[model samples]
Target: MHSLETVILLLVFVLGLALLAQRIHLVFPILLTVGGLVIGFIPGLPRVVLDPSVVLLVFLPPILYSAAWYTNWSDFRQYVEPVIVLALGLVLVTSLGVALLAHSIIPGFTVSMGLLLGAIISPSDAVAATTIMKTQSVPRKIVTILEGESLVNDASALVLLQLALTSVTTGAFSLENALLEFVILSVGGIGTGLALGFISFCIHKHAKLEPALETVLTFVTAYLAYLVAEHLHLSGVLSVVTAGLFIGHKQSRVHSPIVRMQAVAVWDFVIVLLNGLIFILIGLQLPHVVNAIRGQSADYLCVYGIGISLAVVVIRFVYIFMADTVSNQIRSLIHRAPIFPSRRYTTLLAYISMRGIVSLAAVLSIPEKLPNGSPFPGRNLILFITFCVILFTLVVQGILLPLVIRALAFGQPSTDYLSRHEVQKQLSQRALRQVQRLIDQDKLTGIAVQAVIAQHQMRVRELANAETAPLLDQHQLNQKLMLTSIQAQRDELINLRDRQQIDIELFHEMENELDRQEIQWHPVSG
Candidate 1:
């Protein structure tokens, strides 16, 4: 088979495996990674050469952007303090501690090399952490912290990694310069993102186009922001993240429903593909990473890898535990929120410090030759250790994560039916209020007002009935009728707008009202 064909076939197999795993209630990311490792070891398969820079340039931006966009901005704002501590402070502490341990334990390793390794593995892959955590039912606050930490820490870790790499190459380092660069990169990236996002939003607002075209624009915007920022030597990752968050938060207010839904679907697919490809690429690099170690004895490298892995794991645990303690105290004093840190949750959080694609990418990013002309010291060794850490994280930690959750009793009881009913009740109340206001204003009259009011009341009663009985039949019937009518109105509006039968301003006004009505009728939270 042609190499491209072979790659396509492999992707199909992986997708199939993912779907099968879904049926069995298993997480797909872990399965995809394992499948990739197995496929990577097969002989005659084309070697997937993944440059570290390419990984960041191509994959990191979209993934980070999508993550930040979907993140609950309100929750993020509320927990800014803890998020900052975990994202910035914990990363710095872990990097320094790992550097110290690596220098002390590994023979012939320089401080620069140790620090480089430290920076490479310091920030946990938000992709991996979030994917694993999604399967278990955790507290909202805890989940928010994890999500917020993952989103911010990448920028910190990447900045630190670049600084360390530059220091290694130049044979000198300055803390002040590093700090200045961090500030410049962060601020510049955010500025670029906002500028680009606003421009895109304006274009979207004015353009008369299909939903698919708008969706395409969103995809292009993420990469464009990254490329533009990097061309100017700014933080591309941060820029892309900022743009995504801005677009995601505001698109609902600006775009049509069709455009918004289309954009969401497109971004969702892109994120899934990128994440799957990243993990698989990590697995494919295993052999090359092992081959990078030319002079070191296999046994010695294994021993070194083992030691560094232990240090990475232990240091992360200590860092998280300490940060959590400090965060709890601050939260209590400032907000008076209850401090309930489950030991089991903390332990799981500690084990979740798995280094994957990002670590491997950074390790591979080491310059082949230093300024003095000697090849970079222990580059291969660093790669080897990074792979070991990935394995330890994905295999050991992934396998045991569920067991830990079960043992800790961390999964909340399923909230399915009650939650759904509560959401329906809320929606019914909102609809009733809307109808009453329309009647009071003399906008709705006679049969039309009575029909809407009766329907709203029936919905309220059905939701109430759900608390006592399943009410599945009644709920299903109401949902069907409501959705059919919504579709009919949407179709009628589209026809009228296309024919220019309604003035543009009036069309938009009615469409916005319809959108609000649709949202009230079908709340997504539950």
Candidate 2:
């Protein structure tokens, strides 16, 4: 009863915080964490601890799939070197560094436990990365590297974390078996995701599903990959991401206009709610985690937390200078020219790797007891430390991320966005040329062809404003004239209504007729 009430109040508080975030044009992740910090100390407020199983099994798949679906495959592949370095290479480096640092600095911390904690905090959050990229004038390639890293790093970290947790649980560790497990699970998850994606594509392309049913399939597809991979003891995170990448890449060719429209709206709504719930849940769990760590001195814990946090920051900078060495060596063996990103790119990459919800969830999900029924050693401390790292990265690193980006001063305008605009213009022009040829051959007539060409011209204007898009052809000129006449009629109708020359019902009837004709001549969206 009290627990249920506490849950409701927390959700209500999250809702209010979201509104405040929008009002101030602030990032919601930071604000929500701050909100949680505030509420956690409010005396009499019931402590709310998130169920780890619910966080992993229920909350992760959809949100993850949504991120993967929106990821640009071309960008991911184009920056493959840096992406791999950060996602796989950097994760391994950071995990090992944290493990060594924790074991050396903190008393009674075992290698396995330190490894578990390291993996938990190693992932740079997809949400935080995307938010910072959007809020700043960061270079697109830099954004691409961060976003790509975010997509795949979780799989690396989580798999490592699980292996560590297994070591802690059963008191058994084998390098040969662990290596085999990593290979098989990762390969199997990718294979399963590809198979599910193919099946989804076949259904979407051949069945001609209605928008509603197709939208339902989108949700089902996200969960299906997750369930299948986890069932097979594979990496569910990778499976969901792989499947989403497949379907999203094929969206335009497999789905109709209406299906695409409906799916976007539904997915957008689902993602927003999911992100809000996730950060809010993260905030609400802090006080409970803090209160549980009674074994350690408060001062000791804080100092330890600061040390771990600093290790995370400093290690990234140190590692950044070293990571590309792998790529450089590979290139050298092949006799290719050496390539290194500017120092600014390296610095921005280091700064933007902010931790968030998944880290907290991973630490919280640590087993309550070992195989012999003893309480998991240092579980509460691990949870407290993980929360501290998340707060520090999400708040401190996240806040300073924009400054680093601005200082990078990547003088080039966003090449990706400019390239997209150019591509759209070229495509629109090509489409117009084809339509004009049809009219020239008399397969299409004037007003009808003019209407389509006008639409294409409008598209061109959208990519490049009207002043810059080429001067209108005769057909477009006539189309614009027709729209002008229609606007005149709509205005006249409104004037008649205002003067009471026609009843309200009659005015609407006449206006609707004009609207239909207007749509026929010029289909412009406000």
| TM-score per model over all chains | 0.81, 0.83
Global lDDT of each candidate: 0.69, 0.73
Local error of candidate 1 at residue 301 (angstroms): 2.2
lDDT per residue for candidate 1 within 392-468, as digits (tens), equals 77667776776666677766733212243453454456656655665677554555445556766776777777743
Which pairs clash in model 2? none
**Collision pairs in model 1:** none
**Mind giving the per-residue lDDT tens digits that candidate 2 earns over 1-526?**
4877866776788789889988987788888777767776777765556565556766667877877877767667767878887888778888888899899988999888888888999988867666767767766666667778888888788888878888888778888998898888888888888999989999998887767999999989889998999899998878888999898777645665456556777987776666666666655566676777776788989998989988888888787767766667788899985445556767777777688767766776777777788989888788778878878888888777777777778765434232324433544555555556656666656565566667666866676773444433334445644454445445554444343343332443444554555455555411
Residue 374, model 1: lDDT of 95
Worst 10 residues of 2 by lDDT: 414-423
**Model 2 stretches astray by more than 4 angstroms:** 1-8, 325-341, 414-421, 437-442, 450-526
